[model samples]
Target: MVNRVEITEAAAAVVARLEAQHGPLMFHQSGGCCDGSAPMCYPAGDFRVGPQDVPLGEIAGCRFYIGAAQFDYWRHTQLIIDVVPGRGSGFSLEAPEGVRFLTRSRVFTDDEVTELAARGEPERAG
Candidate 1:
Protein backbone atom coordinates (compact mmCIF):
# COMPACT_ATOMS: atom_id res chain seq x y z
CA MET A 1 0.00 0.00 0.00
CA VAL A 2 1.09 3.55 -0.62
CA ASN A 3 1.93 5.48 2.51
CA ARG A 4 0.30 8.84 2.98
CA VAL A 5 3.33 10.18 4.85
CA GLU A 6 7.11 9.76 4.77
CA ILE A 7 10.21 11.49 6.21
CA THR A 8 13.24 12.87 4.45
CA GLU A 9 16.78 11.82 5.41
CA ALA A 10 17.55 15.14 7.05
CA ALA A 11 14.38 14.93 9.10
CA ALA A 12 15.15 11.34 10.03
CA ALA A 13 18.52 12.41 11.43
CA VAL A 14 16.83 14.94 13.61
CA VAL A 15 14.24 12.39 14.63
CA ALA A 16 17.03 10.08 15.77
CA ARG A 17 18.40 12.75 18.07
CA LEU A 18 14.98 13.65 19.39
CA GLU A 19 14.16 10.03 19.98
CA ALA A 20 17.30 9.56 22.02
CA GLN A 21 16.19 12.47 24.18
CA HIS A 22 12.42 12.08 24.24
CA GLY A 23 11.81 8.43 23.34
CA PRO A 24 8.81 7.37 21.24
CA LEU A 25 7.07 10.12 19.32
CA MET A 26 4.02 11.09 17.31
CA PHE A 27 3.18 13.83 14.83
CA HIS A 28 0.06 15.86 14.21
CA GLN A 29 -0.53 18.37 11.47
CA SER A 30 -3.43 20.68 12.04
CA GLY A 31 -4.74 23.70 10.18
CA GLY A 32 -5.18 27.30 11.26
CA CYS A 33 -3.05 30.38 11.61
CA CYS A 34 0.56 30.24 12.85
CA ASP A 35 1.71 26.93 14.35
CA GLY A 36 -1.29 25.02 13.21
CA SER A 37 0.20 24.66 9.75
CA ALA A 38 3.46 23.24 11.06
CA PRO A 39 3.76 19.58 11.90
CA MET A 40 3.97 19.21 15.68
CA CYS A 41 6.00 16.41 17.24
CA TYR A 42 5.56 15.13 20.75
CA PRO A 43 6.46 12.17 22.88
CA ALA A 44 4.03 9.41 22.09
CA GLY A 45 0.82 9.76 24.14
CA ASP A 46 1.62 13.38 24.88
CA PHE A 47 -0.82 14.41 22.16
CA ARG A 48 -4.16 12.73 21.87
CA VAL A 49 -5.28 11.17 18.58
CA GLY A 50 -9.01 11.29 18.84
CA PRO A 51 -11.60 10.19 16.31
CA GLN A 52 -11.29 13.36 14.27
CA ASP A 53 -7.74 12.55 13.24
CA VAL A 54 -6.59 10.49 10.24
CA PRO A 55 -3.68 8.08 10.64
CA LEU A 56 -1.34 8.93 7.77
CA GLY A 57 1.26 6.26 8.42
CA GLU A 58 4.68 6.94 9.97
CA ILE A 59 7.68 9.13 9.47
CA ALA A 60 10.94 8.30 11.27
CA GLY A 61 9.31 5.63 13.37
CA CYS A 62 6.62 7.99 14.59
CA ARG A 63 3.01 7.84 13.67
CA PHE A 64 1.73 10.84 11.73
CA TYR A 65 -1.79 12.15 12.05
CA ILE A 66 -3.79 14.89 10.42
CA GLY A 67 -6.87 16.57 11.72
CA ALA A 68 -9.93 15.30 9.86
CA ALA A 69 -10.67 18.71 8.41
CA GLN A 70 -7.04 19.26 7.53
CA PHE A 71 -6.95 15.81 5.90
CA ASP A 72 -9.92 16.82 3.79
CA TYR A 73 -7.85 19.60 2.30
CA TRP A 74 -4.65 17.55 1.91
CA ARG A 75 -5.98 14.10 1.19
CA HIS A 76 -4.93 14.13 -2.43
CA THR A 77 -1.26 14.62 -1.60
CA GLN A 78 1.48 12.59 0.06
CA LEU A 79 3.02 14.27 3.09
CA ILE A 80 6.82 14.43 3.15
CA ILE A 81 8.11 15.67 6.48
CA ASP A 82 11.45 17.41 6.52
CA VAL A 83 13.54 19.39 8.97
CA VAL A 84 14.59 22.98 8.52
CA PRO A 85 17.26 24.63 10.64
CA GLY A 86 15.28 27.01 12.84
CA ARG A 87 13.24 27.01 15.95
CA GLY A 88 9.58 26.51 15.16
CA SER A 89 7.04 29.10 16.12
CA GLY A 90 5.12 26.44 18.04
CA PHE A 91 5.63 23.91 20.82
CA SER A 92 6.70 20.82 18.91
CA LEU A 93 9.29 18.73 20.79
CA GLU A 94 11.87 19.49 18.11
CA ALA A 95 11.25 23.20 18.56
CA PRO A 96 13.65 23.15 21.49
CA GLU A 97 16.26 21.38 19.38
CA GLY A 98 16.71 24.36 17.07
CA VAL A 99 14.93 22.79 14.11
CA ARG A 100 11.38 22.88 12.82
CA PHE A 101 9.37 20.28 11.01
CA LEU A 102 8.04 21.20 7.60
CA THR A 103 5.91 19.29 5.16
CA ARG A 104 6.38 18.92 1.41
CA SER A 105 3.76 17.17 -0.66
CA ARG A 106 2.90 15.91 -4.10
CA VAL A 107 -0.42 15.00 -5.59
CA PHE A 108 -1.06 11.27 -5.74
CA THR A 109 -1.09 9.34 -9.00
CA ASP A 110 -4.27 7.90 -10.51
CA ASP A 111 -3.51 4.39 -9.30
CA GLU A 112 -2.82 5.44 -5.71
CA VAL A 113 -6.10 7.33 -5.65
CA THR A 114 -7.91 4.25 -6.85
CA GLU A 115 -6.24 2.10 -4.18
CA LEU A 116 -7.04 4.66 -1.52
CA ALA A 117 -10.66 4.65 -2.60
CA ALA A 118 -10.72 0.87 -2.38
CA ARG A 119 -9.34 1.08 1.17
CA GLY A 120 -12.36 3.27 1.92
CA GLU A 121 -11.17 4.03 5.45
CA PRO A 122 -7.96 5.74 4.47
CA GLU A 123 -8.98 8.99 6.08
CA ARG A 124 -10.48 7.54 9.21
CA ALA A 125 -8.95 7.47 12.66
CA GLY A 126 -7.03 4.30 13.52
Candidate 2:
Protein backbone atom coordinates (compact mmCIF):
# COMPACT_ATOMS: atom_id res chain seq x y z
CA MET A 1 0.00 0.00 0.00
CA VAL A 2 1.11 3.53 -0.70
CA ASN A 3 1.65 5.50 2.46
CA ARG A 4 -0.02 8.89 2.62
CA VAL A 5 2.93 10.24 4.58
CA GLU A 6 6.62 9.47 5.06
CA ILE A 7 9.58 11.00 6.87
CA THR A 8 13.08 11.81 5.69
CA GLU A 9 16.10 10.41 7.49
CA ALA A 10 16.85 13.78 9.02
CA ALA A 11 13.31 14.15 10.22
CA ALA A 12 13.37 10.64 11.57
CA ALA A 13 16.51 11.44 13.51
CA VAL A 14 14.86 14.48 14.97
CA VAL A 15 11.83 12.44 15.87
CA ALA A 16 14.03 9.96 17.67
CA ARG A 17 15.56 12.75 19.69
CA LEU A 18 12.19 14.24 20.51
CA GLU A 19 10.81 10.86 21.43
CA ALA A 20 13.67 10.30 23.84
CA GLN A 21 12.69 13.50 25.58
CA HIS A 22 8.91 13.38 25.18
CA GLY A 23 8.17 9.64 25.36
CA PRO A 24 5.74 9.44 22.43
CA LEU A 25 4.77 11.99 19.79
CA MET A 26 2.13 12.80 17.21
CA PHE A 27 1.72 15.28 14.36
CA HIS A 28 -1.21 17.38 13.22
CA GLN A 29 -1.41 19.47 10.08
CA SER A 30 -4.05 22.15 10.14
CA GLY A 31 -5.41 24.20 7.24
CA GLY A 32 -4.77 27.54 8.81
CA CYS A 33 -2.27 30.06 7.55
CA CYS A 34 1.43 30.44 8.40
CA ASP A 35 2.57 28.34 11.32
CA GLY A 36 -0.75 26.56 11.40
CA SER A 37 0.04 25.18 7.98
CA ALA A 38 3.24 23.65 9.25
CA PRO A 39 2.96 20.20 10.82
CA MET A 40 2.74 20.58 14.58
CA CYS A 41 4.45 17.96 16.73
CA TYR A 42 3.25 17.27 20.21
CA PRO A 43 3.87 14.78 22.94
CA ALA A 44 1.40 12.03 22.05
CA GLY A 45 -2.05 12.77 23.43
CA ASP A 46 -1.03 16.31 24.22
CA PHE A 47 -2.98 17.44 21.18
CA ARG A 48 -6.40 15.96 20.85
CA VAL A 49 -7.30 14.34 17.54
CA GLY A 50 -10.82 15.27 16.60
CA PRO A 51 -13.29 13.19 14.59
CA GLN A 52 -12.68 15.36 11.54
CA ASP A 53 -8.98 14.67 11.43
CA VAL A 54 -7.64 12.18 8.89
CA PRO A 55 -4.96 9.73 9.99
CA LEU A 56 -2.25 9.76 7.30
CA GLY A 57 -0.33 6.77 8.56
CA GLU A 58 2.83 6.82 10.68
CA ILE A 59 6.24 8.37 10.22
CA ALA A 60 9.10 7.55 12.56
CA GLY A 61 6.78 5.82 15.01
CA CYS A 62 4.49 8.85 15.22
CA ARG A 63 0.97 9.02 13.89
CA PHE A 64 0.44 11.82 11.40
CA TYR A 65 -2.84 13.58 10.91
CA ILE A 66 -4.36 16.36 8.85
CA GLY A 67 -7.55 18.34 9.31
CA ALA A 68 -10.46 17.12 7.21
CA ALA A 69 -10.41 20.21 5.06
CA GLN A 70 -6.69 19.95 4.58
CA PHE A 71 -7.01 16.29 3.65
CA ASP A 72 -9.51 17.17 0.96
CA TYR A 73 -6.98 19.50 -0.59
CA TRP A 74 -4.05 17.11 -0.25
CA ARG A 75 -5.61 13.69 -0.79
CA HIS A 76 -3.93 13.26 -4.15
CA THR A 77 -0.48 13.91 -2.86
CA GLN A 78 2.00 12.18 -0.57
CA LEU A 79 3.11 14.26 2.40
CA ILE A 80 6.81 14.18 3.14
CA ILE A 81 7.77 15.25 6.63
CA ASP A 82 11.15 16.93 6.80
CA VAL A 83 13.13 18.86 9.37
CA VAL A 84 15.01 22.08 8.71
CA PRO A 85 17.28 24.18 10.86
CA GLY A 86 15.15 27.05 12.14
CA ARG A 87 12.73 27.88 14.86
CA GLY A 88 9.34 26.38 14.14
CA SER A 89 6.07 27.47 15.64
CA GLY A 90 6.24 27.92 19.36
CA PHE A 91 3.24 25.68 19.66
CA SER A 92 5.14 22.65 18.31
CA LEU A 93 7.38 20.61 20.58
CA GLU A 94 10.31 20.88 18.14
CA ALA A 95 10.50 24.63 18.43
CA PRO A 96 12.81 24.24 21.39
CA GLU A 97 15.28 22.22 19.30
CA GLY A 98 15.99 25.00 16.80
CA VAL A 99 14.58 22.84 14.04
CA ARG A 100 11.06 22.90 12.68
CA PHE A 101 9.08 20.19 11.00
CA LEU A 102 8.10 20.85 7.39
CA THR A 103 5.65 19.31 5.02
CA ARG A 104 6.83 18.56 1.50
CA SER A 105 4.53 16.81 -0.94
CA ARG A 106 4.35 15.12 -4.30
CA VAL A 107 1.26 14.23 -6.29
CA PHE A 108 0.52 10.53 -6.52
CA THR A 109 0.70 8.76 -9.84
CA ASP A 110 -2.46 7.37 -11.42
CA ASP A 111 -1.59 3.83 -10.35
CA GLU A 112 -0.88 4.86 -6.76
CA VAL A 113 -4.07 6.85 -6.58
CA THR A 114 -6.02 3.93 -7.92
CA GLU A 115 -4.40 1.62 -5.40
CA LEU A 116 -5.20 4.03 -2.59
CA ALA A 117 -8.82 4.27 -3.73
CA ALA A 118 -9.13 0.52 -3.76
CA ARG A 119 -7.78 0.37 -0.22
CA GLY A 120 -10.69 2.59 0.85
CA GLU A 121 -10.83 5.81 2.76
CA PRO A 122 -8.48 6.17 5.69
CA GLU A 123 -9.98 5.99 9.16
CA ARG A 124 -10.79 9.34 10.70
CA ALA A 125 -9.86 10.37 14.21
CA GLY A 126 -12.45 9.69 16.91
Candidate 3:
Protein backbone atom coordinates (compact mmCIF):
# COMPACT_ATOMS: atom_id res chain seq x y z
CA MET A 1 0.00 0.00 0.00
CA VAL A 2 1.04 3.64 -0.43
CA ASN A 3 0.24 6.70 1.65
CA ARG A 4 0.46 10.45 1.14
CA VAL A 5 3.27 12.28 2.99
CA GLU A 6 2.87 15.62 4.73
CA ILE A 7 4.81 18.85 4.55
CA THR A 8 5.50 21.57 7.10
CA GLU A 9 4.95 25.34 7.19
CA ALA A 10 8.60 26.11 6.46
CA ALA A 11 8.57 23.56 3.64
CA ALA A 12 5.34 24.98 2.32
CA ALA A 13 6.77 28.47 2.29
CA VAL A 14 9.84 27.26 0.43
CA VAL A 15 7.73 25.44 -2.11
CA ALA A 16 5.62 28.52 -2.69
CA ARG A 17 8.68 30.62 -3.22
CA LEU A 18 10.17 28.09 -5.61
CA GLU A 19 6.97 27.97 -7.61
CA ALA A 20 6.74 31.73 -7.67
CA GLN A 21 10.23 32.07 -9.08
CA HIS A 22 10.79 28.79 -10.92
CA GLY A 23 7.62 26.80 -11.62
CA PRO A 24 7.20 23.72 -9.46
CA LEU A 25 8.94 22.19 -6.45
CA MET A 26 10.53 18.74 -6.47
CA PHE A 27 12.15 16.66 -3.73
CA HIS A 28 14.31 13.53 -3.88
CA GLN A 29 16.03 11.04 -1.62
CA SER A 30 19.08 8.97 -2.45
CA GLY A 31 21.68 6.64 -0.86
CA GLY A 32 24.17 8.10 1.61
CA CYS A 33 26.29 7.36 4.68
CA CYS A 34 25.18 7.50 8.37
CA ASP A 35 21.42 7.03 7.98
CA GLY A 36 21.95 6.18 4.33
CA SER A 37 19.60 8.80 2.85
CA ALA A 38 19.56 12.50 2.04
CA PRO A 39 16.97 15.01 0.77
CA MET A 40 17.32 17.25 -2.24
CA CYS A 41 15.18 19.89 -3.91
CA TYR A 42 15.22 20.07 -7.67
CA PRO A 43 13.94 22.14 -10.51
CA ALA A 44 10.78 20.90 -12.18
CA GLY A 45 11.23 17.69 -14.19
CA ASP A 46 14.73 17.19 -12.90
CA PHE A 47 14.12 14.09 -10.75
CA ARG A 48 12.92 10.51 -11.15
CA VAL A 49 11.01 8.50 -8.60
CA GLY A 50 12.74 5.27 -7.65
CA PRO A 51 11.28 2.15 -5.97
CA GLN A 52 11.35 3.86 -2.55
CA ASP A 53 8.89 6.60 -3.39
CA VAL A 54 6.87 8.03 -0.53
CA PRO A 55 4.15 10.62 -1.10
CA LEU A 56 5.09 13.42 1.32
CA GLY A 57 1.89 15.31 0.50
CA GLU A 58 2.32 18.58 -1.37
CA ILE A 59 4.20 21.81 -0.88
CA ALA A 60 2.73 24.80 -2.59
CA GLY A 61 1.25 22.92 -5.54
CA CYS A 62 3.97 20.34 -6.06
CA ARG A 63 4.39 16.79 -4.80
CA PHE A 64 7.35 15.86 -2.60
CA TYR A 65 8.95 12.45 -3.02
CA ILE A 66 11.25 10.51 -0.74
CA GLY A 67 13.01 7.29 -1.70
CA ALA A 68 12.07 4.00 -0.07
CA ALA A 69 15.63 3.46 1.12
CA GLN A 70 15.62 6.77 2.98
CA PHE A 71 12.15 6.16 4.35
CA ASP A 72 13.21 2.76 5.67
CA TYR A 73 15.92 4.35 7.77
CA TRP A 74 13.67 7.22 8.85
CA ARG A 75 10.53 5.13 9.25
CA HIS A 76 10.76 5.25 13.02
CA THR A 77 13.06 8.18 13.34
CA GLN A 78 11.94 11.56 14.70
CA LEU A 79 12.58 13.09 11.35
CA ILE A 80 11.65 16.70 10.74
CA ILE A 81 11.93 18.47 7.36
CA ASP A 82 12.32 22.21 7.01
CA VAL A 83 12.83 24.26 3.90
CA VAL A 84 15.72 26.68 4.09
CA PRO A 85 16.20 29.32 1.47
CA GLY A 86 19.40 29.91 -0.42
CA ARG A 87 20.29 32.76 -2.77
CA GLY A 88 17.56 33.53 -5.31
CA SER A 89 14.89 30.78 -5.41
CA GLY A 90 17.19 28.02 -4.19
CA PHE A 91 15.98 26.02 -1.20
CA SER A 92 16.68 22.71 0.58
CA LEU A 93 15.48 20.65 3.47
CA GLU A 94 16.88 20.93 7.01
CA ALA A 95 16.72 17.43 8.41
CA PRO A 96 17.70 16.74 12.01
CA GLU A 97 21.24 15.74 12.83
CA GLY A 98 22.23 12.08 12.39
CA VAL A 99 20.02 12.08 9.29
CA ARG A 100 21.73 11.87 5.94
CA PHE A 101 20.03 12.80 2.69
CA LEU A 102 20.02 10.64 -0.48
CA THR A 103 20.48 13.54 -2.94
CA ARG A 104 17.97 11.51 -5.05
CA SER A 105 14.55 9.98 -4.64
CA ARG A 106 13.36 6.35 -4.54
CA VAL A 107 9.71 6.83 -3.40
CA PHE A 108 8.15 5.16 -0.36
CA THR A 109 5.75 2.23 -0.14
CA ASP A 110 2.70 2.23 2.14
CA ASP A 111 4.15 -0.54 4.22
CA GLU A 112 7.24 1.54 4.81
CA VAL A 113 5.22 4.52 6.04
CA THR A 114 3.19 2.27 8.31
CA GLU A 115 6.25 0.55 9.71
CA LEU A 116 7.96 3.87 10.26
CA ALA A 117 4.85 5.28 11.90
CA ALA A 118 4.73 2.24 14.17
CA ARG A 119 8.23 3.02 15.34
CA GLY A 120 6.59 6.08 17.01
CA GLU A 121 7.75 9.29 15.40
CA PRO A 122 4.79 11.54 14.69
CA GLU A 123 4.64 12.88 11.16
CA ARG A 124 4.42 16.65 11.07
CA ALA A 125 1.85 18.04 8.62
CA GLY A 126 2.46 21.72 9.10
On residues 81-114, what C-alpha lDDT tens digit does candidate 3 reach at each position? 4544332212343232222222222345667757
Model 3 vs. true fold: TM: 0.51
Best by TM-score: 2
Question: What does candidate 2's lDDT look like per residue over 31-88, in tens digits?
Answer: 9998879999999999999999999999999999999999999999999999999996
For model 1, residues 29-99, the per-residue Cα lDDT tens digits are 99866767999999999998888988889888898999998899998999999999888787798888888
Candidate 2 segments exceeding 4 Å error: none
Model 2: lDDT equals 0.93
Best by lDDT: 2
lDDT of 1 at 35: 65
TM-score ranking of the models: 2, 1, 3
Candidate 3: segments with Cα more than 4 A from true spot: 1-4, 34-37, 77-79, 84-126
Instruction: Work out the TM-score per prediction.
Output: 0.93, 0.97, 0.51
For model 3 the local lDDT of residue 60 reads 54
lDDT of 3 at 29: 51
Model 2 misses residue 46 by how many Å? 0.5
